[model samples]
Target: MVRKNIIISSLFLGLVSASPLHLKRQDLPIDSYDESVAAGADSTDTPPVGDAVPQNVETFDSNTVAAEVVATVVDTPPAVAQASNDTPPDVIAVNLLKRSDMNVARADGPATSCIVRTFNGPQVSDPDTPGAFTSYPAFSTAAIDSVKAANVPSGYAAVPNFVNLNAVAQDKSYITYTSSKLTSYDPKKCAAICDATAGCTSFNIYYERVPLEISKATQVPDAALGCPGNADAASATLIKCAFYGMPLVATSAKSVYQYQGKAFKVVYAGSTAFTKSSGPTVDGLQGPVTFGDAAINAPAPVIDHGYLRTQTFGTNVPFAPELCAASCKAQTEYNAKHGTNKGQACIFFNAFVIYKNGKDGVFTCNYYGTPYGVSYAKNRGQWDDSGNHWTISNSFGYYVPGNYVAK
Candidate 1:
């Protein structure tokens, strides 16, 4: 059968949080994979940084619940190094290479980069779960026939192509999947399993790893223990984003026990809350705060890469970034149509302010809403009217708090 190998490189980006005990950083949305591609593990790598702060007395859960301003930890990766050709599962990040071209007649052919395949290796598949051997869905061959329509990156390396880097997994949490018999199943089912299980914020979908030729007798062992005698042996893993949860269809948890015997739990909703005054303790980071909102004016050119906000100029129409983005997006689309910057427009979110808490520990977002249209720095002096610099711009910047993981 024709198959595609799906891999991802661990492009480790760090996160600093406004709070940790509550596990902040929800606004961050790194690219996952293309809409349809599956993700894989790192074969080569580096690692960590600062400890996570305490999470009040509760937990952070992903359910539709609101948590408090808990402490957060930042991840700092070591410099990059060449990956070993036959690296171990966790040794390096996952990478997807283009295999042989496929038959054009087979509509949902290999061309659809979204169709994913995982690395052949040992895995702890939950035999009872429907997705024990899950695979990326064959969305549509349209993507395949559409590369002729893809917008190549400005300076992409000779590599084929990649879409959503945000979808890929940034954290590695332990897991235990239930099992079932149907080898083929819906991914949503697995998501449900995790969701219903109190603290399962996420889930993993496993398909047979490559080198499937190995005997079926040891297929389980092979996956669980990884290929025979490889020192780098470890199960290949990826994250599942599905909103709903599911039940595993192929394998069941070997033990009703916890992963590595560690207790399984999720961060409870609304556990912690932070105010303008107190932010989380980030390593090497000071309390200096910056509150940002989108400013809306007519569409303007994007000058740099940072948080963006906009304010309207004609009268007092208040602020809205989504509307600005829509306008900006439209302008970019226009550029594309007019052969101008073709699809290049700078749109900031609604105008918000960053509360620059200075070198001190004081911080707040608008810290005060209503009234005199939010505080403004006439100049960078004392809430004053002198040597100003932080000019509360006509447009506000997007609020991008650093990533925060609890210690």
Candidate 2:
């Protein structure tokens, strides 16, 4: 009877241990087993009596040392195997390198002094001062032709900024400005030409519409089909690029154009180089020009159209952004009485220009009739990484009208 009782107890213990294998079966890595079995290892189809059998298991008894060895061989968690195998090689290398001992450097230099100075265009011949305003050189017919001839098979001459053939005729007659037409049309190519030429600040390109049959055969999108006034691609009569010496003054004429047979309706007309000394002059303001508080969400001051202008009084005082602001305010008051554009009240003070020397760096305080606050400096002036020099740019400011007029 005691022997029978011992057998029964052993069976009961085995059954209790076997129940855990069934419970943990879901966590087994099936791929490992299939691969091991295919690789010709001996293992049972059924699980062991006391524990789950690992893939290609060599022995069944826990007392056997080989069984422990087999367990150790397949000890890797399934998730660990998957994660290690699926990761990209580069990602793995990055992680491994990150684990190694390495240090990163940071800037700890002293803050740069905000000194103010003035500069004029290097090529400007008038006033004999570096910062004084001068007339921009006009483009010659030969220069324009040189740009057109350089166009290759795969590039454009000028790109659309905001172009309209009708507007050009109505507001700014090409007759007033120096203009030359290209025998062929390419927006990027024209722009590249302007970029290459110094006097060629801005260029405009016009395209004639494509024929209806060609448009339908090309399967062009509706937007590219044409515009409202000039609705058909074929209706386009001309495709020409015109370079301007000054900012195209904004007129009461509407700013609209249509796709003749191209993707864009407006080719950019802004200049790559300085168009004029400052912006075009208009009436400043009527009555007392009170400098108001620096505006909130101030519109950035732009040149005549979208160009740059400034008066670089030869570098005298230490450069500071505030100095430029003060100078502009003073200039506005001066203009009110004796200035050429007397009514002009606002001015744009830009201190960020090319830094030349320690005491006499490039800076300017330009006067304008209107004070449009800067939205954001397109190129936040800073150190030029390529040139290894400190660069400054217009940060922000607004028109102060009727404020305590700087004496």
Clashes of each: 118, 52
Write the residue-wise lDDT of candidate 2 on 76-136 in tens digits.
2333322322210000000000011112222233223111111111222343221121122
* TM-score for each predicted model, relative to the true structure: 0.21, 0.20
Q: Give the least accurate 10-residue stretch of model 2, judged by summed lDDT.
A: 88-97
lDDT to native, each model = 0.22, 0.26
- What TM-score does model 2 achieve against the real structure? 0.20
lDDT of 1 by residue, 1-407 (tens): 33333222333222222332123312211122111122312111000100001100111132111111100001112121112221101111122222232322322333212212233223433441212323223211212222232422111111122111111111112222332312332234443454444423333332222221111232222323333313222323222222101111111111111111011111100000001111122223222222322222211121112122121211101122232323333333443444322223332222332112221001011110111111322222123244322222222332213311111
Model 1 TM: 0.21
